[model samples]
Target: MRTILQRVQHASVTVEGEISGKINHGILALVGFEPEDTNEDFEWITKKIIQLRIFNDENHVMNLDIQQTEGEILVVSQFTLHAATKKGNRPSYIKASKPDLANEQYEKFLQILENNFKAVQKGIFGADMKVELLNDGPVTIFIDSKNKE
Candidate 1:
């Protein structure tokens, strides 16, 4: 499992010119699942995301976790996170899980996130989505559950 986490003031996802999900004062997570991912990876990544201290406190220090601030979350399936371009100009997504497996993991990931956060929004698993976000601090972090060391 891999994720690109972006701290955002607001974010929303649109599919076919229709708004699917939106959030305010939270993180937008583009999650990718690989063939080797398991439930253990899901649990680890979910915990880390919710507890990550990216939000600022009164003293202007980044010391508050999403759960502490009651922040929302917008999650989107992003197999492209695993795209490999080492061989040629075109990227290969061979490391990305098959759609059937990816969809299952994606749904599980959504369930985990929703269970942790006050509000959680999501994009369709395999739909073409347009995401708009006010990236607070433009803060972004990449996490790989497989390389947790």
Candidate 2:
């Protein structure tokens, strides 16, 4: 599992001209899955995301987690995060999980977030989505469950 976490002042996702999910003063998480991903991967990533201290505290230090700030989260499925491009000009998605497995994991991931946090928003899996965000501090973090070390 891989996630690109972007701390944002606000974020929104639109599908077919309709807003699907949105959040304010939170993180926009672009989540991806690999063929070998499991529930353990989901559990680890979810905990890391919510507990990550990217938001600033009163002293202007990045010391507060999302829960401490009472912020929300916007998650979007993005298989391209697993793209393999070492060989040719075109990127290959062979490392990415198939849609069935990816979708299942994606839903489970969202559920885990919802269970832990008060405000968790998500974009539709396998849908064409347009994501908009005002990146707070332009702070972005990349995490991969498989590469814990």
Candidate 3:
């Protein structure tokens, strides 16, 4: 599993001109699953995301986790995160999980977030989505479950 986590003042996802998921003062997570991802990957990545201390505190230090700040989370499935671009200009998604399996894992990931945190939101899997956000601090972090980095 791979995720691009961004701290946002507000974020929203639209599908066919209708808002599907939205959040305020939270993290916008673009998640992707690889063929090798497992339940362990799901557990570790979700836990890390919720516990990440990217939000600032009273002293202007990045010391607050989402749970501490009562922030929201908007998760979106993005298989393109696993795109392979080494060989050519056009990317290849062979490393990404197949749609059936990816959808299942994506839902399970959302469920985990919902259970562990408050104000969890998500975009529809496999949908054509338009996402908008005001990036707080312009802070963005990339995480990969397999690498543990």
Each prediction's TM-score versus the true structure: 0.97, 0.98, 0.98
Per-residue lDDT of candidate 2, residues 78-142 (tens digit): 99999999998999999999999999999988888888887998898999999999999989999
Q: Worst ten-residue run, lDDT, model 3?
A: 109-118
Shift of residue 3 alpha carbon in model 1, Å:
0.2
Candidate ranking (lDDT, best to worst): 2, 3, 1
Query: 115, model 1: CA deviation in Å?
Result: 2.3
TM accuracy, model 3: 0.98
Please say which candidate is ahead in TM-score: 1 or 3: 3
Best by lDDT: 2
Local distance difference test values of all predictions, in order: 0.92, 0.94, 0.93
Q: Flag regions of model 3 displaced more than 4 Å.
A: none
Q: Kindly list the per-residue Cα lDDT of model 1 for residues 95-123, writing each as its tens digit.
A: 99999999999988777766766588899
Error of 1 at 112 (Å): 2.0
Candidate 1: segments with Cα more than 4 A from true spot: none
Q: Candidate 3's residue-wise lDDT over 56-118, tens digit each?
A: 999999999999999999999999999999998999999999999999999888887777787
